[model samples]
Target: MNGVLFDSFQHNSWATKVLLKVCSQLSAEQLATTAVGSYGNIIATFNHIILSDARYLHHLSGNAPEWLLNRDLSNDFAVLEARADEAANNWQQFFTQPVDGEQLTILVSGDYEIHAGALIAQALHHSNIHREQICAILTSLGIEPPDIQPWAYAHETGRGRDLPSEQ
Candidate 1:
């Protein structure tokens, strides 16, 4: 389970980097321009992704980093990129160590019970959904979004490869 979870986190981080790299090419106006059906613009959407990961990590760890607590969504691209990188590194470190999968109660809007593993899965799913939305927004703006598929990520990272068929 940990291995799978780790892979998912790795893919998530890889995809984020790819998207951010593509977004870096956009002009300031494009980065901030609002698009229909998106959180706001490319920068805003990326900020949401970073903040969401921070919130989940805080719930799981019972400690919120000062930077995360005081994050500004409208910060410059470099700041947002650093925050996203930090969040990804944190998740990598977390899964590299042992995690307690036992059920724990958290107070969000209300008290809810969940396990560590489930929270990780939720984070991964949430990121992917938002990533797709960002991709759609990029397409609408006539900018080609980078491919973020997990299989593509695996192939790029050399962590996975096609196997020959057994006749």
Candidate 2:
């Protein structure tokens, strides 16, 4: 019913689709490879990215941490896919209720406080940044990542184009 809520759902759904496509083609070893260097292995990197944002969500809303923060996995593919699903589900739950963007706030460790909407935006942007990293790693592994354009996911899902229709 709210515009912000709608946008959040759409963006996160697109991200989930991208993550699934990425993990689908990689072998377990390749998914766990640290060839990307300082960013950590693909599975670790993905978990880190999702967990970091979830941590912020906890800080902002006092929600409990999602499973990714504490879980260990013996299988790389399972871990990667599960983390993606967990992160998306958590985000979806958070956005299920609408709050006016202005009513949100980000608590600073010391003194500074930021707008909550800005923090949410930053978290999403952070995820997108790492998604690009994952994409790069996938490309290097000779796995073709899916076309993750928002329009593409929307159309594929029969959710229609994100762009405005022509008159």
Judged by lDDT, which candidate is best?
1
Candidate 2: segments with Cα more than 4 A from true spot:
34-38, 66-76, 103-112, 161-167
- Could you tell me every candidate's TM-score relative to the true structure? 0.86, 0.72
Superposed on all Cα atoms, the candidates' RMSDs to the truth, in angstroms, are 2.5, 4.1
Per-residue lDDT of 1-167 in model 2, one digit per residue for the tens?
44556655566546755675668667878877665443776766666676666665665567644473464433355655565566567767776777555665655344556676777777777777777777788787787777776667668777775677899
Q: Find the 10 residues in a row with the least total lDDT in model 1.
A: 102-111
Position 18, candidate 2: lDDT: 68
- Pairs in clash, predicted candidate 2: none
The sequence of per-residue lDDT tens digits that candidate 1 reaches over residues 1-167 is: 56767778889888988888888888887777776776777787888998888778887876565776876565566777787888888887777767877757484546787887788778988889888888988888888888899989988999889999999
- Residue 90, model 2: lDDT of 70
